[model samples]
Target: MFTINNLLDIMVLVIFMNMQEKLTILADSAKYDASCSSSGSALKRHGDIGNTAYSGICHSFASDGRCISLLKILMTNCCIFDCKYCLNRKSNNIKRALFTPEEICEITINFYRRNYIEGLFLSSGIIKSPDYTMNLMIETISLLRHKYKFGGYIHAKAIPGASTYLLNKLGNLVDRLSANIELPTENGLKLLAPNKDTNKITKIMEYIKENKSQTFVPAGQSTQMIIGATKETDYEIMKRSSEMYHNYSLKRVFYSAYIPVNKDNLLPSLNLPPLKRENRLYQADWLMRFYHFKVNDLLNADNPNFNLLLDPKADWALRHLEEFPKEINTCSYNDLLKIPGIGVTSAKRIISSRKYFKISFNDLQKMGIVLKRAKYFIVCDGKYFVNNLCFNRSFIESNLVLEDNLLTSLKGEQLSLF
Candidate 1:
């Protein structure tokens, strides 16, 4: 009773359903990677489909304070390695899917045309071999670039053991590239992810570092470390980050709070992910990157973990209170940044405004400084903002804690309709 047209319609429907299933599986599998944020690419071409000039193209934010929008998905969830931490490890019995180069292009083009996404964040689990997997990725992105002329941002993950030739080819085609470090220490890698070689990962980073030109990976590279998966402390993690930034010239180092995806004796049996620890690490990382703080300045063997009650900058200020009460009118720009409430922008405003006239406490407020914290640490026009302010550590700490709790309580309260 079925005609040729009806048969064709049924076949098309089946194909669409199959692709939808693949999209669901691959996208869900890709959620764990935190290094997918895009930025620093300015590639534009004449008569191209899209460009990366404005900011970045991903679902999350870039380090430059821009919201990046993209379709973040994995090329495939199939794997050849058996890492204990990975959900898609070959030993785990999970529904697997793979997308051909043509299918990937079709999805990307269709999605971009519909304004569903701005770009693509492509990653993969090892399929057959590292080189084989990387080659497939390169072909998919290459097809997007040449055939579709898609000039939008593309962030690709570099396979750990892929050859230099493939790496070079992939780097030239994508805006940003990342090779995840996975763990802070080589010992942790050996314990949790035996198949993943820390040496191979760093070698990939080194390759990118040495070969990066203006045209190749113009957005630069980033790496991610899984926190709380191993016993390594925050100090150890920061030290590794400092090393990567200095040695590899990385754009950013992302911190992922480990979620228990697989059950193994080697892994921690946590009821929930250590999200608070991750936030603290990010705060410490910001201080290191922007405020010119070293790992030793924040922590050492004596105090290896961040304080749960206070942020890294505030905690440091409390310990080093002798350096505080900085004069707003005369202090250096860097010194202004050391104040808890003064950010980079506010500090710049203070410097620029004070040149014209002496900055008062009201001017500090006008400059967008959080006087609640800065009041205890800074003075303006040779006068304390809070008269007879006690510089005692315990007194200042108790007040700061009370203010933080009040703010948190206010944030949690529901609005009343009068």
Candidate 2:
């Protein structure tokens, strides 16, 4: 004996409960993956509600210590692949749900209209198979692009085993695409995520690179590697990254510091919060991409890993003290690149500006080279800046330290937001 009003109320309550459940499962599952750069778009519809900013945005951080935005969710949480570290592994007992392509489109538009998000970031646990799962994601984007004509940003994961045709179809529809390089090496993949073939991931990245010239993946393809989970050394990671960049012509390679989400006897018992390792890798990555640093030039067997205390640039400067006092006027771009505080941007500015006038030490500072770190590395004419340190390489290395905890500063002080 229920009236229409009672039926409507019941439907509302059920929908609310379903949303709560979906939110918990999705946000929890997405905590591990950190390739969240949303900067690969050239499309601009005049008077459009959403605009893709190259600088990107950090909407918020979840409790598991990852940023959240764009209604980040999995179309389905029912994963078939059993990745040892993942909570959504096929064997794990977790509540799961699947959203239809239309469901996702509806949710995205509703969220956007309500000012809940800028767009959609859709990732999924492999349901049935990688190809099937990939197709579902593709359909979601297609619906958004063709039917809804959603000009808003869409970040979609290129499932490792997904077909090139599917990926190419996706390239035209979505803003940015990614194929997760979950681990540093094939051995790491074999151990942690056995079902995910490393070769397939590499092949997909290769395809993206080949097609980028003609069709283009606007934001370009990006990949993520989980650090500290496997035994892969930092040297090994950087070497692989260098190859990926050269071969794939990738826009970026992200490093996700390993946080042990599930209990496994094989995994480390010690909770190694990944922020420090993550930050150092980012600095090293910057050196590779912009500063023209080779992996071998930056790290090797003796220093198999980045120093947790100091940044890669500072660490490199401290180690190579003999190369210091590089003459500003005389040094080539290659030599300027070797200077600690001088990044690619500063080096170019200094080189370009010097042609007009003889740039002095003060002028070098004005050009954007961080004098604090650069002072010891470069000399203006005959004078040294940071060479005041009396210690040797190892001694200097021990002193140039950074803070351990980033989340505290990022969260409490809101430093990360800026």
Best by TM-score: 1
Each prediction's total of clashing residue pairs, residues at least 3 apart in sequence or on different chains, is 3, 3
TM-score of each: 0.91, 0.84
User: How does residue 396 of candidate 2 score in lDDT?
Assistant: 47
Return the top candidate by lDDT: 1
lDDT, residue 70, model 1: 69
Candidate 1 has which clashing residue pairs, if any? 58-68, 58-69, 58-70
Model 1: per-residue lDDT, tens digit, 1-418?
Answer: 2111223543453366588798988988987887545568876644257777555544545443334476788888878788999988878887777788898998988888776677899999887789988999999999999998898878899999999999999999998888999999999999988899899999999999998887898889999999999999999999999999999999999898899999999999999778768888988888989999999999999999999778789899999999978999999999999999778988888888888988888877777777878888887777876664577788889988888778768887322111
TM-score, predicted candidate 1 vs. hidden true structure:
0.91
Candidate 1 ranges with C-alpha deviation above 4 Å: 1-17, 57-68, 413-418
lDDT of 2 by residue, 1-418 (tens): 2111223543453355566676677766875667666665666633235666666666776665456566788776777788998878877776665666887888888877776666788899886677888888888888877777676778888888877788888877777777888899999899888898888988988887777742356678889998888888899999999998888888888888778878887677556556767777888888888887889877999878987666787777776777766888878998888777777788888888878888777887666667766665666766655454543565444444423234445566322211
Tell me the lDDT of candidate 2. Answer: 0.74
